[model samples]
Target chain A: MIILSPLGWLGRSTLYFLAATGRITLFALQAFSHIFRPPWYPRELFNALMQIGWLSLPVVGMTALFTGGALALQIYSGGSRFNAEAVVPQIVAIGMVRELGPVMAGLMIAARVTSSIAAEIATMKVTEQIDALVTLSTDPMKYLVAPRVLAALLTVPVLVGVGDIIGIAGGYTVAVQSLGFNPAAYLQNTVDFLEPLDIISSLAKGAAFGVIAAMMGCYFGMASGRGAMGVGRATKDSVETAAVLILAANFALTGVFFSL
Target chain B: MIRMENVTKSFGQKHVLRGLDLEIPRGTSMVIIGGSGTGKSVALKCVLGLIQPDSGKILVDGKDARGGDRDAFLARFGMLFQGGALFDSLPVWQNVAFRLLRGRLKRPQAEAREIAVDKLRRVGLTPDVADLLPAELSGGMQKRVGLARAIAADPEIIFFDEPTTGLDPIMSGVINDLIREIVVEMGATAMTITHDMTSVRAIADNVAMLHDGVIQWTGPVADMDASGDPYLEQFIHGRAEGPIEAVR
Candidate 1:
């Protein structure tokens, strides 16, 4: 009888919304639960590795190299006001490994892998392949998400390591040829500034970034709506979420490593 | 054997399935016929556990289909999707043997490939086609490959969702014949959804017409001719002016 009142109606609507959200959260939890079960797909993991790791190297490498070169030039010009141009190589090396390398690698991967995974899985969901997998005694999360997550965790660090090397090489190239720094001295300064902590932090960031990228892709993909527009929306949402989460994760990791 | 008792499914304010009930006997082929959006596909998906009904009980071999060990239950079934749903990144053989090569039922690569090739051959495809990607195959060939993959594990039950949707008439006929032959040879319980009367005639032992989320008529394939229900009559005769309206 109280349903007649305006406050009661608003309360009812709020409760309904909460119930809907609870159902969605339960759905997402069920998906995550499948990650630890048996029937792990090694072949799918291999395929994901090929897709997420090996193929991603060139693009991530290219992006890092360009950013590193630009960073080196900027640092050289900025340091000139204090007659401190010699600081260019060290600052560029630290900047690449500490920030630009991982962030850029993460963003590039979010752009590349998230859209592809989301679109592919969304199409599969739409076309009933996910259903087919379910009817075949297979859990789609285990068969789909786990393998990609594993590959991303194992491979993105390797991608970041490669990116780090390329970026430093980029900085060195510009410092030696364009900034009038000697090759031996630039390499020495880079080596001196890059402590093991920097390397470990960079790798840790890579692993976190990888999980964020792949999770967003799988999450949005499995939850996509119907039709072409639905798939397109899922793809866009996956990329955007992956990118934002990567930067956020990078910030947290950085804070943990240095700020505290 | 499969049975759906008082299945009711609704999305928001729209009712898709309303108090529907159906039964399928073991080792028989049942073709469900209806217009596009009449919930035939939804009914199939519900049986397969891909969609959950608001109220219903689906049983397989007298056991609840929604019970525990769902993986074991699903393992006995295979499905051929409407669009083939082939993995583009993998070769044809790998796609066929996807189930066999993954999970607890995994086979060695060599054995998986061999089985894939054998299944392909069973569907009237050659071994040379195994290495090619799905994108390289024609639509009919892709359907054949999908058929091969469906039967790869020699499942006891199979479901086909518009298996001949995109192919030419000749290709459709070939797929229809292949499905009929495979179902008969394996003695597998089969369920197929299609609006194509030719397919129903060619592949069905029994025909069930779904309209307004309920079975309007169901009988032996021969009895479908004399069903006499105006909806069935119009549907089978492909008439324009009947109870059933075109989407337009």
Candidate 2:
């Protein structure tokens, strides 16, 4: 065997890393192909809806409530500098509807669901459950990835819509109590500042973020290395990738909505 | 009726299979023996089309199995995984009847549950275990569940990957007898990969030894005792000192 020095070892490690990334990309492509095929699993899709959608609502709602409350406080503190406290209603309404609601929900899901999906599937993989699926003449991609991606696509927008409403209500509560704003007038101003375009944009962001998070989780899980250490690595990597990608996509989407 | 022609598979720089060829005749049990990472499992997977070979032809019943109708081709085979690979989220009956519920074989829930229960009974499990999750079962029970699932569909071909790994001696013997009984009764072709000599003695009609990315020796089970290849002798005896290196 050719002995590798420290520098050579580093180089070899980098090469292996790149190769694994390429392999993962290829696997993702194969999975995507199954999406366009027939033999869809309606039951699997329903199960995913329960896992990624209904079960996730409480966490998403709670995160939105607290974030909305905090945003209102921050805006009130900043707006007082210019006697611009009157702008609080429009700013909070617009901010929550356009960015904070969807982004916060997406990040929270990245923390909760992404790591969970990755760890669960990665462990199944290490233990050879995926091979059993193949032997049973079942496509694991169709059974595992399709339902998840579809659930993420369909449910996240709904989650965002709910988050937006709860967030606006949170802002309303804080504005009325601590900021000495009239309840009815604050609500009206909040309503006046919001547009159909802002709501659509938030929902759109939610769907995209949801798909990215699930895809990252499934991709990392299916490509996980051999043992418990490998499954742990996959979970961490999936969450990190989902969080970073959500932020990046959020920025790009913001630029898209606001630029033109 | 499985045939592999000059099959080779490589993961980057390391070659797992080097122009390997194998055939399992119809209605016979062929056991492939090898140490870990010796590509025994990979070869079985290639035949199942779970892993595509780099360059080779795999035929099941004289048709190209590699790129044909994958589901249909797979439907003709059953497999018992080394780890019993049952779906933890599903109950035992659903796991056993997975294919029956999902594909063209879709049946009503009640019927599927009944079939699943019958299959469980065939593996000596009770109907009460049907509603329990795989996680609730012991390792041996889980293996039985996996075995029950494998034979539930009663395919013409079966593949068993280390069917006796991580089991007590009595449980392993039970599993071996179960496998033998199923293969003989159903008149199905079987391909088994294991390092367990006892399993080979219990289940194989023909034995093939895989080492160094190729079949080192192959013969009828009766000839295994006297074939006299040093490598085969060393492996069958489980000697620490042998020409076979311990690395893989």
Most TM-score-accurate candidate: 2
DockQ of every candidate:
0.63, 0.77
Residue pairs in clash, model 2: none
lDDT of each residue in B163-238, candidate 2, tens digit only: 9999999999999999999899999999999999999999999999998888889999999999888889989999
Give the chain A TM-score for each candidate.
Answer: 0.89, 0.90
Deviation of model 2 at B100, angstroms: 0.9
Runs in model 1 deviating more than 4 A are: A1-36, B104-112
**How accurate locally is residue B2 in candidate 1, as Cα lDDT from 0 to 100?**
92
Q: What is the lDDT of residue B99 in candidate 1?
A: 83
Report RMSD (Å) for each prediction in the order shown: 4.0, 3.3
Model 1 C-alpha RMSD to native = 4.0
Q: What is the TM-score of chain A in candidate 2?
A: 0.90
